[model samples]
Target: MNTIFLLNKTKDPTLSEWYERKINDELRALGIKDVHCKAVSSEPMALEITHPLVLICSSSILRDTYSYQSAEQVYAPHAKILAIIVHEKVKFFRHRFTNLQFSPLRFIYNPHRMPLRELIFHLLSQLDIDLEVRR
Candidate 1:
């Protein structure tokens, strides 16, 4: 089974719920029956290293003392980690430490500047899901 872990450390309940629902709906629509999409508000005890993980890169997560350590725990050889920029002012992941810490994750999606549909498409594609027969 494929798994998607959305790590959202921010306090915005409304945005978090919307992101989880929309992503889950899109994955299901793409025929991912055995997939698990979860929105986690804090660092998890353990994460499946092989699964794809989406990190909600916001000001809060960046400034958190444990964010770096938490991100390290999520890193794995086969894991596909994506950072989504939610802050309007953060046009890019240019923070000195952020660039170094999250540099391994090449896929960065900025919903504030780009299309949400595009992010979904990229996410599904990264998971190696076939979108030809979308339901």
Candidate 2:
């Protein structure tokens, strides 16, 4: 199943993209080529366009992407959401909102601090799709 990774442009776009590329590579390792790390700017599109099996995003982007509404309207009924938050965003977010809808990754803080492999493992273990391609 496809995985949607909603990402923002960090202070260093180049470095951020490089890291994103690596994340994508990990997704590839899981045989998920349909992964996407989209910015919040491009929205209002059908959330089911990809019909992703999982949704991942940083906490800082929660409001910026209009994510609450977007996810409510777009995310598939069965898809799980993984919220990757930064250290500063953690305290408030953990208890701030109790979402019964999706299962978040719940890292200590900072999306980057969470290992891409661990993230993939989480998704794979949960989704458990028989990959069509093995590479």
**Number of the predicted model whose TM-score against the real structure is largest:** 1
Candidate 1 residue-wise lDDT, 14-60, digit = tens: 66567788878876676667665777554543254446767665554
| Per-residue lDDT of candidate 2, residues 1-27 (tens digit) | 354444332443344355456667877
**Model 1: residues >4 Å from true position, as ranges?**
28-36, 46-50, 59-80, 87-102, 133-135
TM-score of every model?
0.60, 0.42
Global Cα lDDT for candidate 2: 0.43
In terms of lDDT, the poorest run of 10 residues in model 2 is: 100-109
Candidate 1 matches the true fold with a TM-score of 0.60
| Candidate 1 minimal-lDDT segment of 10 residues | 97-106
lDDT of 1: 0.57
